[model samples]
Target: MRADAVSRAVLEQLRELHCLEPEQTVCCALSGGADSVCLLRCLLELRPVLGITITAVHVNHHLRGAESERDRTFCQQLCAGLGVRLAVYDVNPAARAAQEHCSEELAARECRYAAFAQVQADWIATAHTASDNLETAVHRLVRGASLHGLTAIPPKNGRFLRPLLRVTRRQVEQYLESLGQTYVTDSTNLTDAYTRNRIRHQVIPALEQLNPSVERTVSYTLRSLRREDDFLHQQAQAAYAKCHTGKNTLSGLETLHEALQFRCIAMLLEEAGISCEAPLLERLAALARQGGRWNLSGAVYAVGKSGTLTIETVQLPEPLPEAIPLQMGENRLFSGFVLHARLETVSPAENVANIHKKFANACLDYDKIKGEIFLRPRQSGDRMQLSGRGFTSALKKLIQANLPPERRRTAHVLADADGVIFAEGVGCAARVCPDGETRRLLVLEILGKC
Candidate 1:
């Protein structure tokens, strides 16, 4: 491909995407690779025609040791030759990956974008060509991407623009050759350790054996897919609004078709600050059809019951507050609530079953109440023989059935050394409740919103 053709393609993309404005500033991500080198040079040459200023920003992810510094030096020299301002950022990708608990590739990308964001430009330009998008599509496909992921990278995302997205990787190298420019090669790109490198080196070459122009074909296909995706997203938004109830929950979501319902469920999960993937969203939608419950991330849960789907955050009581010893007959603050425990004697005329009816206060057999009692947040394995109920059940389930989502995080319970004796919202344990022969009673009252 001719250099002029490559440059023209970039200029056309810039204009078509509305990425350039008169007297605007652009920060080009220069990695000293052929693609970035061609992009920076083309933007500089087109600066006069487009009435835009260009600056080169290079991020050195110090994973390749000395080679990383060489890339940075090459970028500095190239920018100097072109009389362009250059900003260099040295980042340790291994350290960042360890800190963020992510892969090295993800850390490098995050660090690169961080450098771009600090450039103070009207637009941040990345050197993603059509071939790069092809690699991205294949990578996401291997990772089980949905239709939206298969659409690949956008030409312009927020303040970031890809001017060379219409051009192929070969065209970029050809453009640099025509300009007699020198570009540095990263040794890691030749290895197949990374998924993208494997795709570029092995998968793409094998794909080209069948369809030589596969990159361009994928580019065309992505354009159509993106348009369809946009339409579906709009429809999903409308459906979500129609089905949405208060407090980040949705009702009657099962009335819509499965496809639209999935999208609406995804939207609701996102609004509830949950990062749900496609498979998880599908599972949640299936559960919605049958009025079931799913445990979501961050101690949140999704319940689809009685034609109403609700997302709730279960608040667990603090461990410190739960460990504190309780003193009888005095009001004490614990986990933002007031608690008062006292010893009471049963009256001769009083009926034990009638006394247990008061749900807020737990009536326990004083003889069974052994050791120092402490209050704490309900834990995962807590089970109790609930008053009136013959069998024991998980405290989490009882809370889900009774209390709202937000209240779960701070729910408190009274427990002796043996186990939980009583829980807020839930009544006293059947085994520990007062009987007809009981005389002294242990009454634990929890005040304020549970």
Candidate 2:
């Protein structure tokens, strides 16, 4: 019942969160620090009363020399003594940073969260105290953020929980002191080399001079902001549903409030696997209203037309298929389609309307062929005169009209030595159309992957 008791704080948080059910499993992320060690112990103390199982996980980010190993050892020993099952994972943050082309801090965070996801538990808890929230607020504010960013960490994000969010760092250390427990101190935390450490040691203490309970004050303010963010997010979700008229399209976004419009646009971008900044969101909003196109990162394009917006991700052209000789059997092309050619002799007096009707675009006049034929992808400047069409059009145009942006790169082109005989979805060219003069017919069909 003491104010400094972390177990009471965790219990109160669980009661309010409703994230746990009877006999559910809870896993604590044991970082071997005072905060993490204190959290693991408090959950152990509360396990019986809460009717839940307790487990611990340790992620050894091999950043520091021997200190990292020391932390891991401490965690193993601590979990063993507490009689709690533990899972340990080792990750190379430096290697991950180099591979991902990002900072070590971000790489380390990714490594830690990925490790947390592997732990088998109904809820995964981390020891982020009120003090950490204050530091996070300062960090996000310095980096330029909106209401959501300023709100910093939430108490519960999906299966992850921050039970110590309402508790202070001072209480964490005091609770450990109450039990005479010792924890490993990471040397990196004492220095200001990292941005988070700089904010924690410098900016936080500076603000503490004005308000001794600045951490508590920031936590209270952030709690209120989080509630507001949740409300806006719910409203935005409803508006997004109403605006979504079809797949990859959103309509009537211009009719909503500017805030709702932005949120709706955000939902659209998010569904397309795009993470945007404010400027990008603003540009998309403008596109949604005025009708235009914005080139997004990674060959993606956001297009707006007739009050509807959509995203198109341009695909890298598949390797041009090696010209394979078209024969009287099936030829499987690397372009993910099979070209089957069946040869048949036809007399001028033969009634072939049924054959042409059944295989309209798949038949070719074999006598019109000048030389051998091959199956391949469309070439630049390639032109095809489709059957029944009077004029020839660029193969590129036909592909653009018939296939999606992603599939156009892999569109098949069937041709003879003279010119293109047939195109995928465009049918046999006018030069190869079967008629009464046709002496032989080459029935061609393109089948999809088996």
Q: What is the lDDT of every predicted structure here?
A: 0.83, 0.86
**lDDT score of residue 90 within candidate 2:** 96
Which candidate has the top score in TM-score? 1
Write one digit per residue (lDDT tens) for candidate 2, span 1-450. Answer: 363468888899878898788789999999999999999988988888889999999999999989999999999999999898999999888999999999999999999898887889999999999999999999999998877899999899999999999899998998998898999999989998999998988899899999998988888999999999899999999988898888778898878888888888888888888887889888888887788888887678999876678887877554576777787887887546777889888766776696687677788888898788888878889998876788999999988998888777666777888888887777778887888778788887778764
lDDT of 1 at 152: 93
Q: Which lDDT tens digits does candidate 1 get at residues 162-277?
A: 99988898888888888888999999898988888989999999999999999888888988898998899899889888898787788887678877888888888888788878
In candidate 1, stretches whose alpha carbon ends up further than 4 angstroms from where it belongs are 314-450
RMSD of 2: 10.8
TM-score of every model? 0.70, 0.66
Q: In model 2, what is the error at residue 17, expressed in angstroms?
A: 1.4
lDDT, model 1: 0.83
Which residue pairs show backbone clashes in model 1? 314-409, 315-408, 315-409, 315-410, 316-409, 322-375, 322-376
